[model samples]
Target: MAKKKKTPNDKNVMAQNKKARHDYAILDTYEAGMVLTGTEIKSIRARRITLQDGFAQIRNGEAWLMNVHIDEYAEGNRFNHDPLRNRKLLLHKKEIKKLQDAVSDKGITLIPLRIYLKNGVAKVLIGVAKGKHEYDKRETLKRRDQQRQIDRVMKRY
Candidate 1:
């Protein structure tokens, strides 16, 4: 029997915040659903979302995603969604409470790692992260360089 091949729609990643990993020490991760407008959904499906400056906050018992830029759909007219609007994240009450408590601590924050479509629905991967210090950043870079060198040597064999 042959294994089934995965299709693009299987795990369509829309946008990722590459800088998040370099700047923060991720402690825990959670998957949350997003509340998006029609045009926003279209733009996301078209791969026009940017998670570079995105972050999440728990306010009034609700989780809100901020600074994520989902470009307006090109074909959308007056009803086009705002590119930088704050979107609500759908997380369970228990999860939200835990995130809120964690975020209340000093130097800890909630960052969006990536957004992807699962079973035709959009989901955001969020991380409970603590900011990295200068020396930590340098150490990470050094380790990454060493890993690259090891990979190159292995490939040559």
Candidate 2:
């Protein structure tokens, strides 16, 4: 049997924060399991989650996913989870310690890069990123355009 290949567009990926890639220079990434409520999981399975302004933080020896918006499950009655609640991220103690140390550095922060389901479990990919300057953003775009042009030319041959 062939090993399954993974891509950004993998069928398991439910939501992606493309804006996070544009706004931050990601240095490192970690995959973490999410502790979701019943309705939250339902909403996520329906592709009703947003990662636009979502971030992660290491607080008091635990990791927390903040500002991620998972819409309420329509069938849920009064037991619906809050759309903007801070959800717990399940990572090892060593990982949490390392993340805390990395976040302690000036100008470094944690941002959720994407959310994907792995083996029926919801997981989040968080990035340790540094803010890019305006000029840096422009440079990145220019590089991207040049790469596209190169690909186009190569494809013609």
- Give the C-alpha lDDT of model 2: 0.92
Identify the runs in model 1 with alpha carbons over 4 angstroms from their true place: 1-11, 154-157
Once superposed on the true structure, which residue ranges of model 2 sit more than 4 Å away at CA? 1-9
Deviation in Å, model 1, residue 61 alpha carbon = 0.5
What TM-score, computed on C-alpha atoms, does each candidate reach?
Answer: 0.89, 0.93
lDDT of residue 12 for candidate 2: 81
lDDT of 1: 0.93
Residue 134 Cα positional deviation in candidate 1, in Å, after optimal superposition: 1.5
Highest-TM-score candidate: 2
lDDT of residue 10 for candidate 1? 34
